[model samples]
Target: MNSHYDVVIIGGGMVGASLAMALKNTALKVAVIEPYPIPDARGEGYQPSYDARSTALSWGSRLVYQQLGLWEKLSEHVTPIKKIHVSDRGRFGATRLAAKDYHVEALGYVVPNEWIGMTLISALKTEPNVDFICPARVEGLKRSEQSTCITLSKQNPETGEYDLEPQSVTANLVVIADGGRSETCQKLGIEIQTESYGQHALVTNVTTSKHHGYEAFERFTENGPMAMLPLGESDGASVGCTDARCALVWTLPEDEIDAVMAMPDAEFMALLQTRFGYRLGKIEQVGTRHHYPLKLSQAAEQVRAGIVVVGNAAHALHPVAGQGYNLALRGVVALAELVSEAAGKGENIGALPVLQRYINGRYADQDKTILFSDKITRLFGDTSAGVGLLRDMGLVGLDILPGAKRLFARQAMGLGGTEAKISS
Candidate 1:
């Protein structure tokens, strides 16, 4: 295998794979170093980005995917979210945002994480300019005047252990998209600011007695915020289920997650119904449950002379607003555009100026999104009467005022503020 390339992306998860795809048409040669190998279509083995979890893609993100020529491939697998219903439990405050009001076909779309991973990975395999180095761990990084050298150890496929001797790959640029808890970023001395939300997000798929009508729900309860996103009909039909299937993201106190996870399906559904109410009628069935502690984390520095960190490696936020991946997608788009331009200009893509340009272009959007996600998580998580009152008022205002609804909807759609150059 060639040891030198124009760019090497560390981590081949959603963001990393997206970056590779975004740069496929460019002339620059690229490599992706991933710790885990892509799983076979029939295998039950763990796939990093391809899991049972579902992600909400904002409308602007849909446009970005469309521009990349991937929307058609993914559209069939996704469930269009025609409306978003948000409310505070036991309060009169509620708001609804509809696609018709905004003149958009849908506000957003819900897609399984596996579908995205499979789509991006399959597309990446066809890119002649990209090399995929899988089941390999990046052990060390060295930046020199000419290139960044990455030290890697390949994992034995059968044993799933790194037993090979260290090998090196030198590239003009190195991009880190390894995810929120990036040991590479820490090893490189990149500072990260983190704040635990004292909450845990319990996720699962649930079937409703009534049709979801392609509506997404966000209900703020005393425990925390819960989101029910509509799932594609095919998913339920494949399992011989006729009821509507929706992905549930329920936030609860960290200490209570164990008990909740241990609860039987019927008992759990009953508890979920109590908090979320029967917006789509009774919760009839729930698939496997998963839990993860929540936190807000952001890398203090996202770029340097020869390296740039994108996606969860840069910022991981609470799921309250569903902005983490959308924000990362925007950053990826901005970086890809800048890198392509730099390559076309015969300039060093890893040079400080070029990397700084990427950072400068994306910093404002990142800042605003990080702030928005953090604020929403904190505000909705607050259980105090005063804060609760403010939350109700805010919901009421968003419901009653078209202008306010539009602004919030736009932000949620990832179309608010200055648009990324790639989107334009």
Candidate 2:
């Protein structure tokens, strides 16, 4: 194998794979260093499974996948979100958005994360200029006048530790997409600034008595905000109901989740029905439940000479608004676009100025999204009666105003804001 490459990505998850796919057929030779296995020579394809985890992909993100030629496979298992209902529980005011009002086929789609990751990886397997370095980690890095050198280590299968010494390689540019709490970012002196939201999100998929009818619900209560996103019908055995399944993300106060999570399934379903109301009718069943604290996180420095950060490695937003992944998708596309253009011009793609160009195009959009998600999180998460009334009125005003609704819809769809200016 070559000792060096034009570009090397530190992660091979969805965002990393997307960038690799976007840069394919170009002149740049690229390598992806991932700690997880990459399906190569195995001829792997995505298999539909029951009770699989899923993600919500915005309309703007769909365009990016289309550009990269992965949507056809993705669309097969996705459910379109045609209507969204945002409301404060027991309040008279609410905001409603519909795809028909926006003149689009659908507001967004909910697809399994497994399907997305598998599809992206499967597509990249056959690319001529791409190489997958699996079960590897960036143990150390040294920067020179023109590039960065990285030492690799292999993870032990049983111990799951990066204990095996491996070869070192250099790259003109190193893109980090490992995650928000990336060890690579730490080694490179990039700090993650985070504000805790004092809330934890409980997630699971549920089968209901009634079909979701392609509608998504974001309902706020004294506990916290909960979203019931529509899921597509793939197989009756997968979720027990072919036409009546929805993914649930329920936010609760920090102290209350453990007791709630410990409740039996029947008790949990009853409590969920009580809080979420009968919108989906009776909650028949729930898959495995998981929990995580909500926090607003950002990297202090997204770009520097010879290195760049992308995906959750760069920023993480509150999930209720569903902007985190979409924001990262745009970043992936913008970086790929700028990198390709710079490589074509024979410029130093890793130079501080070159990498800063990507950040410049990304800043406005990034700021707006961070603020937007924070606004939603803080406003609805408040428990004060005063703030509750104000939140209800805000929802009412949003519903009454056409321009405001359109603008908000555009932002939610991932098409509005200056972030789109970032060479996508």
Candidate 3:
């Protein structure tokens, strides 16, 4: 337990696990510290019935998974997003991006968040190079000129109990992938710039009588955008006949969230149908709904003396474009690649300049994504007539202009106009 490792990743979620797995065959030693209970194979399908969280993986992200040999591992649970439909309801015609046009089989894939976590951890359990420590939380972190040392306790960090007896582990590099509220980032005094959107996103799954045909919809309404991402074909044998299900992300004003949630099933369905305008056609059944407050948070900088922030710790963008995980995926890929290169060169893998390269490689794209998502929030959420007109015209222009549409499609898929690049 006293031995040092090449790298320590503080968060065993998707981003952290992916980074660790990517480094598996390399010479670098890896350790993942997570407070939550790791998903065991027996508990794989028994996810919390209350969790309706979902993620839309971009094409670029899919490539990263493929490279890590994970795409095929969890392919059964994923549904392809073949087409993206964007529109301003009650106004201009919608803009569409087709997978065929991009010459890719699909624009992206939709996977439930719980499934994602389970699949990643299941894979990590088999990775020989990784040391998985769960139910173990980090209590304190300090960096020396040569390496970083962190204190770990068996209980969760918040509980302040040292049941396992405090232990110290140092690593050449430390990556903080802790989610939105990252304790490691806080302990390091990393500053975050955040914009709390006065909105709450209600997420769930809905089945329609008609087939979705693998189309993903982003309908901009007065309240906010409502997204319906198609899931895989349902087993036609089911009683609900809900074979064609789609994940829902309905954003509403914070003040209106409770009102919407309190509405009877029938009333709420009616409201959803009206907003989406019969596109999906008759919300036959809706799954359990989960609401989350929306906010845009960006780390002022991602690099520290011995640590580099990754995932939600580094940036948490608005889910309006469903780029939170996609952005995180890009960050994970970049950091892993940079670290691997440093290891290959026999350099001080966690040297300031080495870590700085990782930070510099990540900043531009992360910044653009944060700004793009934040701008979309402000632009559509404003609801002012002038803003409406502008957005409408922009939609129209995007539809008619081929170049603009292409650029928009690339950007939407987390693959454009940024230094931090994720290859697909």
Candidate 4:
């Protein structure tokens, strides 16, 4: 609604909302432009369905949210991951990581994506300087030395079309966190370098006969790696639902995904039980299944003169290691700190130098995470007996080796690489 702003974030998803939260109480005037309005879950009451999607938040991410003053509320719905079990399916090597051994309360936490979005969006209502503009999208961009001008197209309620606004908004900086597929990013001449894994991830929630015990499992098969992260339980009592619920990311080859997706619940569960084993007992009940092609996507350029891309728009890693969102959250905190400091000094927050600073600091961490996820996917994907044997041996070595597991665990927990701290 304002004609100009200090910062205009292009996407209102978790990353953008978090940046807004971090910048709260700062002097800068911020705005978040969102095409999708927050889903209103008020009418029928909240019900945690087995079909719900969950996100894994590393231990380092916990510190960031705590800094944003959201952990107290997020703690209510999240389940702490006490241990991580990494094993090569049907192989002799397996490794286990426990939080207590590392002197941390948890390795990570899993929370439903819906819960995170709702919490962040709802909390934005009280932010005096951060304004949320929903049901709107960017159509045009014109950048200059001083600022960038954005053309807005308001969504039409009656016809579900967009009506362009005659007046545009100007901002000292434009932060794009729209997602992997962003038309605005392309329009700005930023290129995304993507390496396709030629694999698809079958995502769903399942109820096991036994409690999950707050453990996460990463089982590598010949074809791909599949992960079953512990989700605490259903929000309310549901038919045939038990206390042990988990979020499953079963990666499969592209050729076999269609057939697998079409299989009956019983057949699917049987197949999953065979592949995953009964570590948590039986896969008793399953929820709706969704699938997405897996790939490694990175923006060739993350910062421009007055624009910065964060989150999935910048880089989307394979869910094999669950590093995508955690990496993006670190970027969010870094950008907020830099922007706040620039604002305090009355400097141009969107200057190329300021934006480049963010990229400079985050490049190594991004490289490590992207490589780690890709290597895991490729390493486990090899069906050759030689590679498989070596991989198994590596797992065994990881288990017994000194400091190897700790370093690996630190990377998984988003605590490695250059540290990005919020400047208060």
lDDT of each: 0.88, 0.85, 0.80, 0.85
Query: Lowest-scoring 10 consecutive residues by lDDT in candidate 4?
Result: 42-51
For model 2, name the residue pairs that clash.
Answer: none
**Highest TM-score against the true fold, candidate:** 1
Q: List the residue pairs that clash in candidate 1.
A: none
Error of 2 at 221 (Å): 1.2
> Could you give the candidate ranking by lDDT, starting with the highest?
1, 4, 2, 3
Residue pairs that clash (backbone atoms under 3 angstroms), model 3: 234-243
Point out where model 3 deviates above 4 Å.
44-51, 156-164, 233-242, 417-424
User: Per-prediction TM-score, please?
Assistant: 0.96, 0.94, 0.93, 0.95
* Residue 55 in candidate 3, Cα distance off native in Å: 0.6
Candidate 4 global CA lDDT score: 0.85
Off by over 4 Å in 4: 40-51, 164-166, 234-242, 418-424
In the range 1-424, model 1's lDDT, one tens digit per residue, is 4799998999888899899988988988999998887755453445577788999999999998988889898886888899999999998889999999888999999988888887787788788999988788899999999899999998887787886689999999999999899989988999999999999999999888998899999998888999999986654248665638999999999889999999999899889999999789988889999999999898999998899999999999899889999999988888888999999999999999999888987878888888888888788878889988989999999999888888899899988765554357
Deviation (Å) of 236 in candidate 4: 5.9
Please give, for residues 264-290, the per-residue lDDT of candidate 2 as tens digits. 999999999999999889999998998
Per-residue accuracy of model 3 over 15-103 as CA lDDT, tens digit each: 88878887876878799988766768755333231134778998888887888888887676778888999998888747888999989
Specify the poorest-scoring 10-residue window by lDDT in model 2. 42-51
**Highest lDDT scorer:** 1
In model 2, the number of clashes is 0
